[model samples]
Target: MTDSASLPQDTQSATRPALPVRLKAGCKINLYLRITGVRENGYHELDTLFYPLSEPSDTLDIEEGAAGSGLTLVCERADLCTERNTLHKAWRVFAETTGFRPDLRLTLTKGVPDGAGLGGGSADAAAFLNFLNASAGKVALNDEELNEVAARIGADVPFFLKNVPARATGIGEILVPCEVDLSGFTLLLACPPEHVSTPWAFKAWDDRYANKMDIDATERLTLSAHMFTRPSSRALWLFNSFESVVFAAFPKLRAYKGSLIRHGAAAVVMSGSGASLFALYREMEKAMQASESLMREGVKTFIHHL
Candidate 1:
C-alpha cells in the first residue's frame, strides 16, 4: 500500500474511507470573462475568473454498482443521463486506462440548471472524478495526470478538479490559483427559464469583436493574487463578454440585472453567457431580499458565499 503522503495530496491511494460515498459537485460563476481571439483550430481563447460556488448544486451519491464492467450514472435530466456527459465519459476513460472495472453506481441529484452558463455539467463531472480518485483503493492518476485527462475531457473539467477559484486562459483550460476569500460577501445568482446556447453566443461575440482591433486579445489580463486577497464588494472587478450579445436576445435577463441593482447589489452581471445573472453584495440580508423579489416574480435563483 502506498502512503497517501507519497502520492499527491489531492488524489486517493489504495485505501480510502468507507463506501456509500456522497459528494457535491459545486457549480461556478465567472467573476470576470473576456473573449480573446479565435484559435486556428476554431476554438476561441478566453480570459476569465471561475469562482466555485460554496453550495454544491449537483449531488452525486456513489456506491458499488451491480457486478459489471462499467459505471452506472443516473440523473433527473434525460438529456444528461447519456454517456455523452462529462461524468460518464471521464469514468470510461479512467476504466479503460486503468483496466480496472469500475462497478460504481451513481445517483445524481441535479440542483444546477443546465445551459445557464453556471458550469453545472462541468461541476458534476469534476465531482465524480475527484470522488472516484479519492475513494478508489487503487489510484489511476495523480493530480497532474488527472488534470491532463480532465483537460481533454472538457475545458471546464480541469477548473473543477480543484474547488478553489482560478484565473483561466487558453480556451478555459489554463488554470492558475487565484483565491479570493469572498467570505464576507454574498453572491445572488438568478437563473431565468431561457437557456442560451454557448456556441451561438460565441459566434455572436466573434461577429461583434472581429471589427474591433482596439481590443487586444493578447494584452496580459492583469488580475493577480494581491488583488483578490481580501474579502470586499469591490475586491474583484466584474465583467463578462457574453452579456453584450446575450442581453440583446434575452430582454428578461437584461431586466433581471437591473432589478438586482435596484434592490441594492454592489455589482451585477451575467454569470457566463446568457440568462443567469448574479449580483455581489456585502450583506446577506440585502442579497436574500433581492432573491425573494425575483422569486416573487417567478425566477429561479440561488445564493452563494465563500
Candidate 2:
C-alpha cells in the first residue's frame, strides 16, 4: 500500500495543473435488513445486504490548487450548502489525513432526493475521498482506513466505500462481499414526497412492538445461496425487518409499496427504514415502463438497470 504521508511533497505540485477530478457516486438499496438490538452506545445492531445501483444521483468535482481553502458546492438543493454538505467534511478529512491541501472546488449535482433512505450523502463522501486519493497520488489509505473514516461519518458510509453488494453487520460497519449477481435485473426506485426519521422509526418500533416481537429470531433468518441465485426463489425471501414497524407508523409507505406492485413490479419492498421503496424487474424495459407509469401517477421515480 502506498502511504500518503511518505509521498514526496512535490506530488501535489505535479498534479496541480490538471483539470478538476470528477467521480460519479452510486446509490444503494438494502436487499434484506434486520435490526437485532440496540447497543450500549445507543447505536442499533443490524444485519443487512447492500446492493449498489448502476446510476447515481450526485457527482463530486475535486480541482487542485491550497491547504485550509474552503469548498464551493453547487447544487440546486439549498439544503446541500457548504455547512451541511458531506463533501465539506470529506475535504476536511482528506486534508487532515494526506497533509496536502490543494485548492479544490466541488460541485454536487443533486439527482437523489435527500433523506430518501438511498445513501446519497454516503456516496458523495466516499466518492470525494476516493477522488482525493487518486488525484493527489496518495493511495495511502487502504480499504480498512477508508472504511474507518466512512464509519465516522454515518452508519451507512462504509457501504459506499466498498461499492459492491455486501452483507453488513455490527452497526453496519462490518462488511462481507456477497456473490449475488444482478447483471440482468432492473431496479425501480420511488421516493415519495415524505421523509421518515430513522431515529423516530426505531423508537416507534421499540414503543409499539418491542415486547411483541423477537428480534433475535428475526436476525437468525438467513437466505439460501440458491435463493440469491434465482430471483424467483429470492423474491419470496427478500425482506426488510424495519418495514412492518415503519409501515404501520407511516401508512403512506405501505400504500407506496402497493402502488409499486400494482404497476407490474416483480417484488416491491421498502429500502432501509422508510420513504423510499424499490421494485425489482427482470427486464429493463419493464422497469422503465413502470417508472414512467409511476411518474404519471404523481410518484417520483428513478430507474436503473443493475
Candidate 3:
C-alpha cells in the first residue's frame, strides 16, 4: 500500500512560499431527493434539489510546503488523513490530470459531521479542488473541465463547485441552476447521534423496491423541469424517497422529525439519506425554539437563516 508520503512530488514548494489560504467548506441539504432510476453501472440516478447551507461548515487551512513534500493532509479527524479521503484523492487526481503538482500542507477542522447525509466530505474535496485550481497559475482547469474532474472525484462534488441552489440529475452530476427563494425562511438542522451509511441506505432502498423501479420514471419525467415556484405545492415537494427505508431502519429519526414538526416547523424532511433532519420555518422564533427543543434532547443543531 502506497502511503501519502510515497506519492509523487515536485520542487515547486521550494520557490512558492505563499501565504496560507483558508477556505470554508459549506454543507448542502437535499430539499428533495428522488431516486429516478438505476443504471447498468449500479449507479442510481437522482432528481434532487440541493440547497447550500452556510452554517455548520468545515474549515480548511492550506499553505505551501517544503521541497519534495508532495501533498500532506492533517485533519481534525484521524480517519480523514488517509489516502482514501476525498481531499487526498482530489489532490492526487488533480495532479495526475493537470500535472500541476505543488507541495502543500492542509489542516482541516471539521464542523460538519460525517455520515449525516450532509455532504461534508464532498464539500471539503470541492473546496480543495478550487484551491488547487486557483493556485495552479497557467495550468488551471476551466469551469467545465473542473466540473468534470469534480464529478470524477465524487458524484456530488461538482455541486459544491458552484455551491448554490441546484436541481441535480444523472447520478447527481448534472446540475441545473434553479431559483429557490427562501429569503424569509429559517432552517433548523438537527443531526442525530446515529450514523447512517449512504451505501447501505441505497442498497436497502433497492432491495425493498426492486419491482417498483419503473414507478418513479413517470414522476421523474413529469417533474424533471419543475421548480419550487408554487406555495401550494410546497408540501408535496418536501419529500425524500430514502425516508421510507431509512426511517424504517432507524426509528429514532422518524421520531425526531415528529419532534421538529411538533415544535412548529413549517416543513421537516431528512436531508439526503438519514441521520440528519432539517425543518423550515417562516418565523425565526419558531426555528430557534425548535433548535432549543432538539438540543435539549441531546441532538446537535444548527440554525441558518436562508
Best by lDDT: 3
Model 1 C-alpha lDDT per residue in residues 129-167, reported as the tens digit of each score? 766666555555777877887887789988887868899
Candidate 3 versus the native: TM-score? Answer: 0.88
- Rank list by lDDT: 3, 1, 2
Q: What is the per-residue lDDT of model 3 for residues 139-225, given as tens digits with 9 covering 90 to 100?
A: 778788889999999999999988889999999999999999988888899999899999999999889864555556676455432
Pick the winner on TM-score between candidates 2 and 3: 3
Worst 10 residues of 2 by lDDT: 1-10
Off by over 4 Å in 1: 1-12, 135-139, 211-236
Regions of candidate 2 where Cα sits further than 4 Å from its true position:
1-17, 64-68, 210-234, 283-289
lDDT preference between candidates 1 and 2, better one: 1
Ranking by TM-score: 3, 1, 2
TM-score versus the correct structure, for each prediction: 0.86, 0.81, 0.88
lDDT of 2 by residue, 44-79 (tens): 767789988755467655554456565666776777
Which lDDT values do the candidates have, in the order given?
Answer: 0.74, 0.70, 0.82
Off by over 4 Å in 3: 1-17, 214-234
Task: Give the winner by lDDT: 2 or 3.
Answer: 3
